[model samples]
Target chain A: MLGEINLEKVGISCFFLSYLVAFAFEVTRLIKKSRTSRALMLLFAVAGLCAHTIFLLVRSRAADLPPLVGSQLDWMLVLAWLMVLFFLVYSLLDESSALGIFFLPLVLLIVGSTYFVGQEPRAVMEGQHSLKMAHAALLVFGISGVVIGFVIGLMYLVQHRRLKRKHGQAGGLSMPSLAKLARWNRLSVMLSFPLLTAGMLTGVGLGLYSQRTPEPVQLLDPVILSYGVVWLVMAVLFGWLLRAKPTAGKQVAWLTIWGSGFLLLTMIGLQVLNMDSWHS
Target chain B: MNLQVVYCTHHGTDLTLREKLAFSDEQTARAYDHLRNEFPDSEFVVLSTCNRVELYTAQESAKNVPTHQQLAEFFAEFHKVPREELFDDLLERTGPDAVRHLFSVAAGIDSMVVGEPQIVAQVREAYATARDHRASGPLANAMFERALKVGKRIRTETGLSEGRISIASVAVGDFGKSIFDRFDDKRVLVIGAGEMAEETLRYLHAEGVRDVVVTNRSIERAKMLAGQWGGTTAPFDQLDELLGQADIIVSTTGASRPIVSCERFQEVRRQGDPKEVFILDLGAPRDFDPAIGEVDDNVFLYCIDDLEATCDQNRKVRKKEIAAAQRIIDEETDEFMQAVYHRATGPIIRNLREKWNEISQLELERLFGKLPDLNQEDRDHLEQCFNRMVNKLLHPPLEVLREEAREGTPHGLMDALKRLFHLRD
Candidate 1:
C-alpha cells in the first residue's frame, strides 16, 4: 500500500502559494502591526508547512526513498520545510517577534528553487547506500543550521541599524534585541561549522568506502571540491567568531550573514542549476 | 440640569502655575469646604493631578449654575493666585462638550503623555474623594462611574496604552533592555543626582538592577540617591574610573559643557577591555560629547534629543488612536446627555399624568352620582374603562415630550405643554 501511494492532490505549488501569501501578510504587518495580520501570517505559515510536509511525503512514497535522499529538488524542499517548521514553532513561542519577516522569504526562496532543481533521485551505490544516506542527512542538517544562522544574522543587523538610527520601536514590528540576536548568531556559527565538518568527514568516509564499488568515487570530484570550498568558508567564519569579542555584535552579525549567505547560494546553485557536480 | 468643567490643565496653562495650583490632600479638603460654602446648591468634584486641576460641577438647575468667571475667581481666592494670572488659562466646557472632555481625560488621551495609566487612577481617586467629602450627587456619581468604564473600555478595545511613552521608560525599556538581556548584574553608573536619573533608575531597578554607583559634584546628594537605591556613591573625581567599570551610564547635570569628551572617553576605554556600554546623556546641554558615541562600536551614547525623537514618534502613533477613542466618547456623551435631559423632564411628565387623572376622576364622580342605582361592579368596570381611555389619550403627547427630551432638555416644548394643559411645575 505504501508503494502504491500517489501525489494526485498535493504538489510543491500548494505550499508555495501558502508561503507566498504568508510572506505577503508578514510584509503587510510591517506597515501596520496588528494581531490579525500576525495571526494570518502564522496561519498561512503553518498551512504551508503542513502542505510542504505532505508534499515531501507524497514524493518520498513515489520515489521509494526519504525526501532528503530523493533528489536535489526534494532536498531543497526539505530545507524549506525545516525553515517553515522553525518559523511556526518560534512564532508560537513569541506571538509577534517580527521573525516571519526574515524567515518566510528564505522559505519561499528554497521552495521556489525546487522547481528548477533535479527531481530524479541520485544513483545510490547498492552496498554502501546507508553510508550515502548518512552523508546526505548530515549535510541537510548542517545546511539547516546555516539557514537559521543567516536569518538570525539578518535580524541582528536590522536591530542594530534600528538602534543606531534611534527609531522608536515600530508599532507591529518587534525583532529580537541585538543582544539576543548576536548570541543566537554566534551559537549558529559554532554549531553549524562542526555539523558541516562532520558531514564533510562522513562524505569523505563514504567516498573512501566506495572503492569496492563498480564506480569508485574520485578524490577530485566536483561534488567533493565544491563542498570542500563551502567547508573552508565555514571554517574561516567559525574561527573568526571564536576570537571576536562579545561586545562586537554588529561585526559578528555581518560576518555570519556573509558566511551563511555564501554557503546557501553555492549549495543551492550547484544543485538547482545542475552545475557540473560529480554527484549529478 | 447642567454639567460644567472649569479646568486649568497642562494643555494651556504654565507649568509653574500648575505646580502652584495643584491641590495637596489638605488643600483639596480645604478647597472642598470653600466650594461648599461659596456654592451651597452645586455638586462639585475636584480632579487635581500633577497635569491638571479641574472642578467638575453638576447642578440641578441650569439657570443658576456658576459661571466660568466665578469658578476662576474661586481658584484664585483659594490658592491666593492673582485673578488675571489664573483667569486666562482657566478654560470651560459645558453640556455634552464637558462630558466628552471628561471621557477623554479619563481615557488618558488628553494627558501630557498621551495614554498614560496614572491619569485613570487619579480621576478615580478624585471621584472617591468627592464622595467622601459629601460633595458628589447622583449626576456626579453617574458621570464618574461611566468615565471609569470608558477608561477601561478605551484601554482594552484600543491600543492607546500599549507602549511606553515617557522618556525615562523609553530609555530603559526599549533602548536599554534591547542592548542588555539581564540588568541585575549590570553595573549601573549614575552621574549627577537629577530627576531623570532617578526616574531611569526606577525603571532599571524594576528590571532587576541592584548594583548602582552614583557620582556627582555634590557627593552628599550622590550618597543620598545611592542610599535610596540600595547602592553606594563615588566621588565626582572618580567619574573616569567609574566610566571604565560601568556597563550602563545615566548622566544628567547642569554643566555648561560636555563632561566626558571623546578623548577622555577613549582614555577610559583604554584602561580596560572595551565592552558593551550604554550611555544615556539626559542633560539639556549634553554632559557627554556627541563624538563619544562615534568613538567605538561598544559605546552606545544617546542624548536627550535622540530619546525625545523616539518619544515624539511614539506620541504621534498614540495620537492616531484619538479618533477611535473619540467615536466611543461621542456616543457616550450623547447617551449621557440624553439621559440627563430625560431626567430633567421627570417632574413635568408626572404632573401631566396627574392633571389628566384629576379631570377624569371629577367627570367619573359626576357620572356615578347621576347613576346611583348602578352596582359597585358596574361602576368599577366603568372607571377602569375611563382610566384606560385617559392613558390612551395622554400617550401621544407624552411620548412626543419624551422623544424631544432625548435630543435636548426640550425647554420650549415643556413650556408649551404646561401652558396648553394648565399643568403646574
Candidate 2:
C-alpha cells in the first residue's frame, strides 16, 4: 500500500500538516513541560522534514534541475527546508528548548507563499548555466543566513525584554542567555552580510555578461532595483557593525531585524507580484 | 520510644527572637554537656541558624523525657533569654510530629526562604556536632541519618530547589554568571558598603571573586566591609577610576539621583579595555541610570527590581512543588513511626518467646524424670510434641501484637501482655 502511493502526488499539504502537528506539540511544552511532548515534537519534525525532502526531490527530478535554481516556488521551499534542518538540529540538541515556536511560523509562511509564486521553469543560456547555478546557490545560502539572523535578533530582543522586566523564564519559554543570543545574532549578521555581498557582486557579473548576449538583461528592472536597495541597506548595517564600539546588543538586534526583514519581504513580495525581469 | 523538639523558627518568631535563642558552636558544645548532666539518659541535638533554633531530644523512658516547658526553661537559662518572653514563642512537637518536623526542616520546606540550600548543611553539621559531643545515642543517630536521606530524596524527586530565590543570588546566578564565565580573574568593584552591597558581595565572593575594591562615601563602612571580605578599600573620590578598572560592579548607594549617568559611564568605558562589565544596581532609588544599560554591548546593568522579579518567579515555581515535597515527608514520617513502634515491641516479643521456651524446657525435664522407664525414641518424640504445643499457643497472641504495631504501639495490649507474661522492660 505504501509503494502504491505516488511520490509526485504528495503536495505541500503532506508536510504542512506534519509541521502543523509539530508546532502544536511545541506549544504543549509551554503549557506543561514533558519529555514525551518534546519527543513527539522531534518525531513530527523529522517526519515533516523527510516528506519535505521527498517533495523537493520529486519536484527537482520532474523539472530536471536542482531545486535551488528550479523556480521561485522551489527556491522558497528550499529556504524553508534549510530552516527546518536548523530547527530539527537545535531541538534535538536541546529537547526542552522553544526554538520551534519562533522558527516554524516563518517556515510555514515561506512554504505558504510558494502557493502564490510562479512555478514555471526559468530558462537559462546553455553556456551560462554554471554561472546561474552559482549565483542562485550563493543567493539562497545568503538569504537563509539573513532569515536566521532575523530570527536570532528577534529572540535576542525577547530575551532582553524578559531580563529587563525581571520576569523569570515563564511558561516553559526558556531562551538562551541574552549574552549568548546577542553573540549569535551578531554572528548571523556578520556572516550573512558577506555572503549576501558576494551574491550581489556575482549577480552584477551575470547582468554584465548577459548584456553582451543576444537577449541582454535589463539593469533598471524593478526587481533588480529593489534588490540593489536591499543590498545597500545590508551594506550600511555591515559598516555600522564594524565601526561601532560593540553597539548595544538591543540596538544591534533591532537593526538586524529590520535589515533582514526588509530583504525577506522584498524578495517574497517581488516574486508574488511577478515583477521580476530575470527569473520570470 | 519518645521524641520531642522545642523550636523557634521564622514561622512562629522573628529573627531577633531566633537570635536570642540561637547557640554558637562553643555554646552548643557547652549546652550539650549541660543537657547530658540535666537529663542523663536522653539523647540531644541542637540546630541553630539565623532563621531558627531547634533542640531535638529522644529518650527510651517516658518519665525521664524532658517536657516542653522544661526545655523552654533550659533555653532561657543557657542562652540568657527571658522565660516569659520565650515560653510562648517556642513551639513544641512530639512523637510523629517531631519526626515530620525534622524531615521538613532538612528538606528545606520549613525554611524562611523556602528551598534554601543552607538548611541541609546546617542540619548535617548539627547532627555531626551532637555525634562529636557524644550527646547522640542510637535513636538520635538513626533519626538524623534518615532525615538527611529524606532531604536528598526530596531534592532529587521534586523541583523545590531548582531556582535561586534571593535578590543577591538571582542577580548573580541569573544574570552575572551569564555575562562572565569565571569570576576569579575579574576585578570586582563594590560601591556603597551597605547591607545589600554586602549580601551581593557575599555571593560574588562565593563565586571565587578575590580582588574586590569597596568604595563608599563613608570610609569607615567601606573599610569594615572590605575587611570582612578580605578586600582592599578604594577612595570614594576615585569611583570613576574604579569603574574603569573593574570588570564587575555592584552598586548599592543610597543616593537620591542616579550615581552613574550615561555620559559619565561613557567616559569610564572609553578609558577601560573593551570587556564585558556586569553592574548589579541594588539601590531602591536606582543608583545607575537605566539608560546606562543601553550604553554599550559590554555593559549589563540591572537594578533591584529586575532581580526581585526573577526571585518572585522562582519563589512561585518552588511553591508549586511544595505539595509533592509534603507527600514525600508524609510517607516517610508514617514509615518512620511504624518502625519506631515496631522497635518498641521488640524486647517484649523476645521476652515472651524466651519465657515460653523456658517453661517448656522445665516441663519436659520434669516429665522426663517422672517417665524414666520410657524408651529413648519415645522420650525424644514427647519433647518435640511439647515444643510444638508451646509454639502453637504463643503464635496467635504474637501475631496480633505484630499487627497492632503496624498502626502504632499497642500500649494497652502491650501492658496486658507484660502483666500476663511477667515480662520486663
What tens digits encode model 2's per-residue C-alpha lDDT throughout B1-425?
89999998888798888888899989999999999999998999999988889999998666778889899999999888889999999999999999999999999999988888889999999999999999999889989999999999998878788778889888887787656557889899999987988998889999999999999988999999999998999888898999999988988888999888999999888887657788889887999999988877667788888888788888988899899999999999999988888888888999998998999999988988998899989988998998899889989998999899998778899999999978888
Q: DockQ for each of the predicted structures, in order?
A: 0.45, 0.16
Best by DockQ: 1
Task: Estimate, for each residue in B91-112, the C-alpha lDDT of model 1 and write its tens digit.
Answer: 9999888899999999998998
Instruction: Give the Å shift of residue B17 in candidate 1.
Output: 5.5
User: Which digits, one per residue and each the tens of the lDDT, describe model 2 over residues A84-155?
Assistant: 999899887875577988898898888888888888777765567777778888888888988998988998
User: Interface RMSD for each candidate model?
Assistant: 1.4, 3.4
Off by over 4 Å in 1: A1-8, A121-134, A208-219, A276-280, B14-22, B27-43, B59-90, B131-138, B152-166, B320-324, B335-406, B409-425
- Please report the TM-score between candidate 2 and the true structure: 0.73
